[model samples]
Target: MDLTYSAQDDAFRGEVRDWLEDSLSGDFAGLRGRGGPGREHEAYEERLAWDRHLAASGWTCLGWPPEHGGRGLGLLQQVIFHEEYAKADAPARVNHLGEELLGPTLIAFGTQEQRDRFLPRIVAVEELWCQGYSEPGAGSDLASVSTRARLEDDTWVIDGQKVWTSLAHLSDWCFVLARTEPGSTRHAGLSYLLVPMDQDGVEVRPIEQLTGTSEFNEVFFDGARTEASLVVGEPGDGWKVAMATLGFERGVSTIGQQIGFARELDAVVELARRNGAIEDPAIQDRVTRAHMGLEVMRLNALRTLAGSGTGSQGPEASIAKLLWGSWHRGLGELAMEVAGGPSLTAQGPPYDLDPFQRLFLFSRADTLYGGSNEIQRTIISERVLGLPREQKA
Candidate 1:
């Protein structure tokens, strides 16, 4: 995989850096580092405004085609934008679920009518989305979903529960996976449906986490109705479309994620030195190993993107998932170890946690969400290595 940046690409990077600096340094300065995992409630309204500002400045969807309201940039240019954005410490985006996942899926797989109906809203951040693949019974094994939907008159009626749905409470719509055929088992007869979230039939209850935040949620769809035409692909082709969306979930932004990881690692290293934890050889060894892991994560992501197409990150994307998820969790542990005894206590009463404490707590789920480490290993073994599938009970 080539890592060289051309003169034009370097100029593009400069433009992105300058715009982010100017934007974040001015009226939006308060949002420089607000709003992320474990802290999604921090200045949320302002962060939403920051997202709109990004959309207006034409900086939100860099790699999508110009016809679809994106810059149509090359892969490396996209990488440069992400690196610069992370370096600038911009606020976490509010519509990433729409911009990164659904936008690309519609562009690649949706009908022209579907693209016309959804792409504009996604581009302008007028709507936010959440994935409904994981049901109460099916979290990592997504194909085992039991949510049911059926066509009635002119609408599709849905009924089921989706747990661990991030941003559901704030989302305007949800893309759901449901059993469209009666008594359908496992993967067959499932449909990818775009269901609106504001109807009386829908309910969203927040799930509080160890970090004392409720960014994740449980959504109940009791006869939730969406337009019959809202199905993404063919009725039974949901698995293909869903898998592609998951691929996009592990897209080029992972490079920026690693950048954030590096920053956090640097902070932990400083904490160790200040607290004298670095005087101990074991703490020193863990910190050094974290630095090395970050480098390897970056190289592996670049290699994976080299073989991937525009929207699909490919089956080997599991390897990237396994790598970063475990590495970030490990970094959290190292942070706690560096902090020594104080990491065990909260900064304030009622579960008020300092950033380091929050990191240690929230990173606990990094390996479990999106796809669990065990599930990722299974995908790598069966899909990438062509190993025989494990026998199920």
Candidate 2:
């Protein structure tokens, strides 16, 4: 595959970069400068405003059809746009679940009414969305999800729980997967539904992480009701729909995140230099390794996109996830080592202090989220390598 961009692609990149620079003005600057994980409510609102601004400019959904408020750009242009957006230090948009996952899935499988109802709200950041896939018992083994949504008259009555739901507390809706058939086998009995969070019988409780923040939540559905029209695709075809969302989540979402990771890597290098650790041979080696790891990830992502076209993720998506988890873990460790005792204490200036300390703690979850590294290995071995399936418990 040719790594070099065509002349037209290069021009498109310049246009995107210029647009980002102009769009990220006063408040955007302040929000982007806030380096740590936590952001104030005002900051989040400002970020949403920026998202809306991008949507209005037709840059938000770069790869979507023109009718859907996008530029109808290709996959490479979309990737370039993300890369430039990160470089501009723009505030990260909070509508990722909607823009990155749900919107695309809806386009592929949802009815025209469903698309018209959700896609516009998603683009405007007027509605926030969360994924309801993982449960108390079912996580990496997603087919084992037992959240039941039984048809009751014209509505589906949902009852079960979803754990580790990111931003669910602040979300307006949840794209959920639940078992619609009692006797049918796993993976064949499920259905996907989009349920409003404000409705009766729906409860959301925040899950406080070690970082002292409630970014994720445990959601309960106690006979919650959703119209049958909210269902995506036919009943018993949910596994396929869920996989499509997961593939987009694991593949394209990683592209955006890796751009952020590249920025973080640069911050690490700068931190090392300021701490007088740049001269250390070991530190230099770690920095080089981190850069190399990110390059490999970039190439892998490009290869996957080029080979599949239309950003359809394949088994290699799992490999990218695995590499990302490992690379992030190593980078975090190296950052902590370079920072020494001061890294543990979080009292200094946010930018001057060790950013990696928080990153290191967060990296612990990287290997586990969106299916664990062990599960990725299983996918590679069984699906990619054509190995025999392992015995189940």
Candidate 3:
């Protein structure tokens, strides 16, 4: 596949770079410090402002259809925009679930009314969203979710708990998966719904981590209610609709993240150089491995995008996710090693800050979230290698 950028793509990249350099100003380095844990309030506000700026310029939803609030750019332009945004070290808008997963799913499956109501809000950064999928008992085994949604008079009453919900405390709404039917098979009884977060009967409690911050939440829904019109697709068809959301999550969203990770890898190499670790053969080897991993991921993203039009589900997407997570964790670990003692502490002078330390702490969740590496391996084996499915009792 031709991964080369055309003249127009190059021009778009340059424009995005210039705009970000001019518009995105706040202590991004400080925001980077606030990256790990609970309620980086200032960081969140800055990111929201940035999102609004991009939305006003029609840059926030670059990949969306023009009939929606986007510029309707192609995949190449989207890639270029992300690359430039990473280079600028801009704080990414905190509405990834809305922009990446829910918006796309709505475009593909929602009624025109749903699209008109939700898509514009997402583009304008007026409504923040979180994915309400994982539960205490169900994460990688997503189809095993037990959150129940019962049809009432003109509404669906939802009751269950969703754990590991990122940014749920700050989200305005959630796109959730709930069991609409009991006793059905794991995948068949599920349904997807859009529920407002601030309503009564919904409680969000933060889960503090080892990093001494809480970026995720335990969202408890006790008789949460939404109109029947809020149901995405048909009831009992949520398994299929959920796949569309997860496919975008695992495919396109991962590509955007890999771009950011590549930049962080570069920062690691520079850190090694500054710390006088570049001369060590071992350090050099680690850096080389990180570079190779980034290249593989980039190529895989390109291949996936190229074959996207043909409706092909290649193994490269899983490979990309697996490799990116592992490589990022490695880079984070290596950064700490190169930084030596100072990296152990989370606080220090600006230039003396240990990026690796923070990254290492955060990277621990990479393999666990968004379908673990083990799960991806299973997908590759069954779907790509033509292996027999493991029989269940």
TM-score of decoy 1: 0.99
Over 145-252, each residue of candidate 2 has an lDDT whose tens digit, in order, gives 989999988999999999999889889999999999998767999999999999889999997665556677899999999998999999989999998887777644
lDDT, each prediction: 0.90, 0.82, 0.79
For candidate 2, the lDDT comes to 0.82
lDDT of 1 at 315: 88
* Candidate 2 lDDT trough over 10 residues, lowest sum: 33-42
Per-candidate clashes come to: 0, 0, 1
Looking at model 1, which ten-residue stretch has the lowest summed lDDT?
A: 303-312
- Regions more than 4 Å wrong, model 3: 25-42, 251-255, 310-316, 346-353
What digit string (tens of lDDT, one per residue) describes model 3 on residues 78-154?
A: 77777776666666568778988899889988999999999999999899999999999999889889999999989
lDDT of 1 by residue, 100-200 (tens): 89999988889999999989888888999998989777999998999999999899999999999999999999999899999878888899999999999
Clashes of 1: 0
Off-target runs (Cα >4 Å) in candidate 2 are 33-42, 348-354
Q: Which of candidates 2 and 3 reaches a greater lDDT?
A: 2
Q: Candidate 3: how large is its RMSD?
A: 2.9
How high is the lDDT of residue 133 in model 3? 95
> Clashing pairs in model 2?
none
Ranked candidates, highest TM-score first: 1, 2, 3
Could you say which candidate leads in TM-score?
1
